[model samples]
Target: MHNVSHGLNDIASILSNPILNTDSYKASHYLQYPPEASAMFSYIESRGGRYGRTLFFGLQMLIKEYLCRPITPAMIDQAKAFFTAHGEPFNEAGWRYIVEQFGGYLPVRIRAVPEGSVVPTHNVLVTVECDDPQVFWLASYLETMLLRVWYPITVATQSWHLRQTIRAALEQSSDDLTQLPFKLHDFGARGVSSAESAAIGGAAHLVSFMGSDTVLGVVAANHYYNETMAAFSVPAAEHSTITSWGRERETDAFRNMLAQFGKPGAIVSVVSDSYDLFAALDVWGTELKQAVLDSGGMLVIRPDSGDPQTIVLQTLRALDASFGSTLNGKGRRVLDNVRVIQGDGVNPESIAAILAAMDEAGFAADNIVFGMGGALLQQINRDTQRFAMKCSAIRLGDDWHDVLKDPVTDAGKRSMKGRLTLLRNRHTGEYRTTTLPLEWDERTAESDWDDALVTVFDSGKLLIDVSLTDIRHRAHAHEG
Candidate 1:
């Protein structure tokens, strides 16, 4: 069983302390994004893409797993026991308030950028506000829970940047940009920390691409974003399936794949490096050549080991020589009925390097597909994008005060002040955050700038539930 207690800190025991400065109980806290997240990418251009996804994902799970049901007397007793055992006074009044008022509902209002809109650094992706003064700290208390959105958002942004790279390469080398969505496939599910992480990160990748082997990710997209089937995969063979036939019968394994999936226009991938990749290719070119040609399906040759760029180029050259090739309009060689999929050593830099090498080798970008695993999902953290949630404004009684933390030690950690609204410049389409007084009405500020943030959650209900199809369309519409 998954341990829920392992996820939280001891400080969480005091989260509901009503004795925490009686003044703070009545204050309204504002959530804003500060300007320290630009360092996540190597270049500014690479950071441009739609962000703020998985907005309600974490909250929904938190509710179902921890807070949706009624708080029982036994639970309250355990909370008291835990604090007392640690030599701390349990705040009974605070716990009572949480039990009485916070049943199956969060009392905060969330405003955020519509999911999948291109967002720049330092702009507020989301903002939270409390209607009840006593629950002002409620949103802040949920920071640990809400911050889980960072994983999916970062994964989505990384995948989107990779899409841009592949699209640019294809645009320069081939006339068919329609295949851009399937160029990069998600093979990262098994390498992720957990099934949930795979689901979230995998769905994030599908926001830009269509090829994926992660079924859980597609399930996640359907569950969280109202998508039916957001990703796809071809019938393929792994080392186990091929090697089960033994090395001597490898040609039979190759023949079986063609015989089974080799209908008109069927696509199947066979891992070619199980024994000798060169020998496997030779067999496909000689003994299995007639079977491949007569099967009427495209054979995708997969090379799992070796230096990615060099191996892919060598494999492409060998395939061209064996299958024969025709020149496309761009003068790049398009392999006859065979293709290559390089799943090893594929990250952003290596992907760029391989595509460049392929162009130099006179091969069309469409002649190969790229599969990524660990780098796509597990290689990032919250620090990758410098994500944070901070209070920028607080209300005491009838007055509002601008709150900020500007330490001399680190300027990057300094927080923004006052209630914030994200604004999009009409002419340039760039986004920026505007700090406004708590009294400033949004209706008055709507003329000069388009308010990029919309109310997504309010009074325990989801106000905006965007479909994955719409999100994909919005994400790719601005690619030009």
Candidate 2:
């Protein structure tokens, strides 16, 4: 239930999405010169004034498609001092050479958890390593991607945890403890940055979660990756609202709803707050029950006002008494078909609280759902979830030199100086790194330090499949 914090820049207002509106013909010419080049430029476009935290992911995509190889120093030099004069500290020449050497190697290494994994904060959920030292500086420029990718994944992880907590509460609240179909809703798209990021974030949440994301999420995951269509398998659902002062409105809103979506098993969401919630529940309970049964669809009631705990209890009781007669020979109940999704300021903490309340009131876990938005999506990790590019181990003077960044400030922004091996402990299985003198810098340490770099590419060809899902899964496994 702990929330991630954020800073002002992190929560900046979203930017508008339109490029080159200066002139129609000129804009069209600049924006649509060619398919490949135009595609690359969009990576940096400001979508609705907000770019996803990981701006570099878009850059990576651009580079992969257009640059198509490691950029070489020769390429930089050929730019005739434009890159050098820009005051970029990178050895423009050396980087160009390294790129030419292994640009196709796809030098970046990303170690991250699978799309679905419950991970704690401060856990090294992802570790990205670049293969070439000459291009190590490139890592710095790409911090945006690292941030963007990790943030959503982390948020998704926490969201899933919240869902699990809700399920637990509903089950314990019920008399029979039957599991319920909790449809997870994705309402974070508009609040998120871009179409691409929203889609990606939504898809990341959907792989092991559920939601409605921007279009590209489906296109990228399914059309491009050939993965299953990412969506909740549930049929249809509903919406509702509640208010302060306890006025509840059970407006035959259900009738109008059925007129649109229609019938049994059809999904309907009713906001139950216009007057006294309990009174509204007692009055409308029978009608709502009859409508759901008659339509062959399920009813989804949403409580947007009042203490979720108290409101849920009152409504549950009213619902139980009205629909109690529908329980059949096996003691199974018809209310089993209904879902109570709680929202409006629901977050991980509030979710935990409501869950505890449901348990106190004997409501089944599977009988409810949750729609998490602002409180959930807007949360940011503020512990300085940092992963900086460091040259810990480098080849020098026929041996690798160990490097260390003396502490610069309270930020702990020091870089490693010598050649180091990031090794996995065989016995404890935790991460440990060792510094080695450059002279003995072989493929690995003689003392058996595991070589962190695997042959991702060889002879201009990829040596491994580099499956994103598989890699994500491996990273998730490392989370303790």
Candidate 3:
């Protein structure tokens, strides 16, 4: 966290000066897609299905971070001095206009698929346009900031995929599917690159799952999306909490957790692998079973190391054998009062494997949960889903020009052209991107697809302020 604060200060001066942006963007005003380009429309899309195409997240946060702060004269002076010292030419005129006319707020309109929609790959998720002709370059300039949305969007999509995977397993193994929302927990705050990254990426996970240890993510959801207490965590103990009691009194350590939080319905997670996991489980199943059952609260035993699928299956069998089990409506055995959580080596792939194995073992999915750290928030990159933002269309003085990059080297890198509209194929409910005129009206035309993109940001104001609850609801709707 300290590292992040210092890093933010390092770039604070440059970010404050909007003109200190990329050099190629400086020529964008004059040298555009074509000589007559007046308005440039760019869109963001995912080209792969590794994480699915749920996107356009973190827009509100991007707006608040870059657009809300006013560019000041002091910032301009600092930019001028910094650029001149480095023998670089600064866009003085551009910065002046932005400071005077735009009042530091971006003069751009952003249309996006509502956050949490399960969009398909190779479909546009967001479109950006600038109303001011002189600031047509602003569309792509904002891209520099807005493109950061890829991180959160990717994280959200990955988490959503995990949710779908869990839901499917729960449907197969558990009669009660309501616990799906809490199946995957976020333990990635400490594993991410920075505090801001943790907040954004963690909140993205919350869009699908409700379990999280990242308090800043909850704060971010509340601050950016009007959410209140968007995610939750349980009272838990780490290895230190157990080891500090010594191996001789290990049972005392476990007993202390129950004594601290033993109320009915209270849940506390204990990292049971601090010493010998099997030995600890043996003691828990034998010496501590009556105390745990009498306490009325559920105890979540955490296995933090070893092959996740194998360890989880072993833990489930051991727990069920000792704690006893009852068959759910699905005829799958669920633990009587205790559950297992595999926090180690738990990624989307491993999660699927674990669930499948558990199902095959005749154990209910509701008997266990997963805690993911780096894989949940930090392991992925923009290329994981092949996300890209490209200018699809440019309006000349009196004509609209379609623009695209058709690189012969890599066909996969080819981009879409012309004014793009994201539409959902009604029959399949799959999102598709189409090239159409800017003035094309859907009201007067009959089409097989419904427009999926909506105005989210228009000229510095946020048009849509979706709450976290609403987003969760939307993400879950597709499960039906």
Best by lDDT: 3
TM-score of 3: 0.92
- Candidate 1 weakest ten by summed lDDT: 37-46
Model 1: residues >4 Å from true position, as ranges? 1-92, 102-104, 437-448
**How well does model 1 score by local distance difference test?**
0.72
Per-residue alpha-carbon lDDT of model 1 for 1-480, expressed as tens digits?
Answer: 122452224444334422221233222222221222110000011112244322212333222333333444445555555545545555555446656777525566777777777677666777777646544555565555556667777888888888888998888888799999999999998999998788888888888899999888888887777777788899999999899999899989989999989877999999999989998888889888888899899999999999999999989988888999999889888899999999999888899999999999889998999999999999888867777777667666655567777989977777777778778866677777776542455665555467777877665567777788878887877776
Supply every candidate's count of residue pairs whose N, Cα or C atoms clash at under 3 angstroms: 0, 62, 0
Query: Cα deviation in Å at residue 234, candidate 2?
Result: 6.0
Give one digit per residue, the lDDT tens place, for model 2 in 1-480: 111221112222101111110122321132222222201000011111111221111112222222334443333343323323333332335444555666524355443322233323322333334445444333333444334554445454554555456555544444443232234565565666566656555555544344443455545445333456545433333332233222333345545565566565566666655555566566556655565566777666666687776766666666777665244333333355565767666666776776676555545454566676655445544222343433344333234334445765743454444434335434444444334333444544445454333332222333333333542354334322
TM-scores, each model vs. reference = 0.84, 0.62, 0.92
Ranking by TM-score: 3, 1, 2
Whole-model lDDT values for every prediction: 0.72, 0.44, 0.81
In candidate 2 the C-alpha lDDT for residue 411 amounts to 35
What TM value does model 2 have? 0.62
Superposed by TM-score, candidate 1 places the C-alpha of residue 33 at a distance from the truth, in angstroms, of: 21
